[model samples]
Target: MKKADLEAYRQRLMLLRARLCGDVSALAKSALHGAAEQGGAASSMPIHMAELGSEAFEQEFNLSVMETEEDAISSIDAALRRIEEETFGTCTGCEGTIPKMRLNAIPYAPMCVRCAEQEEAH
Candidate 1:
């Protein structure tokens, strides 16, 4: 990759990392608060069993979403490390040059399109 393109990718990866971090932090805070509220005296007093079920379902859904966000943050962190190592835009699966378009679409992509497709096929 050209110097300019590499720099751009670095910047993009940094921004993505920042955004994912913020999202993860917000999700954690929301989950904590929700848990605390559910553990309060009113919650302990309890209402309808159906209402309790709904709250449980909502908490599980929020936790699932938080897990997804955490995964994204991990990917972004790896991408940033690759940038620092001067290995950004190189496919890990094939060691080929990853297209700039693909990088733009997914700044944390670790494989080129062909390798990604092949992996999916298997």
Candidate 2:
């Protein structure tokens, strides 16, 4: 890849990392500490069992999304390291050049479309 392209990707990746980090932190706060801790009215005890179940489900959903965001953060970190090591825009699975479109859509993608599809098939 060209030096300018590499730098641009680095910047995009950094921005994405920052955004996801903020999302993960907020998710952690909401998921781990109930809404009361986040400036909401203290309603730790639900008046009905169904409300308690709904709250549990919401917390679990937040945790699941938080985990996915954390995984994206890890991938972004790896992509940044790859940039520093001069290996950006190359597929880790096949060492093939990842198209600019894919990179533009997903700056931290580590595989080409073909390889990614194949991996998904398996």
Ten-residue segment with the worst summed lDDT in candidate 1?
Answer: 37-46
- Provide the lDDT at 10 for model 2: 96
Model 1 regions lying over 4 Å from their true place: 43-46
Candidate 2: Cα lDDT at 108: 94
The per-residue C-alpha lDDT of model 2 at residue 52 equals 78
- lDDT for each residue of candidate 1 in 11-95, tens digit (9 for 90 to 100): 8777877887787788788878878887777836448899778877877887898789789878888988888898988999989
Question: Backbone clashes per model, in order?
Answer: 0, 0
TM-score of 2: 0.90
Q: How many backbone overlaps does candidate 1 show?
A: 0
lDDT of each candidate versus the true structure: 0.84, 0.90
Summing lDDT over every window of 10 consecutive residues in candidate 2, give the lowest-scoring window.
35-44
Q: Evaluate candidate 1 by giving its C-alpha RMSD to the native, one decimal.
A: 1.8
TM-scores for candidates 1 onward, in order? 0.87, 0.90
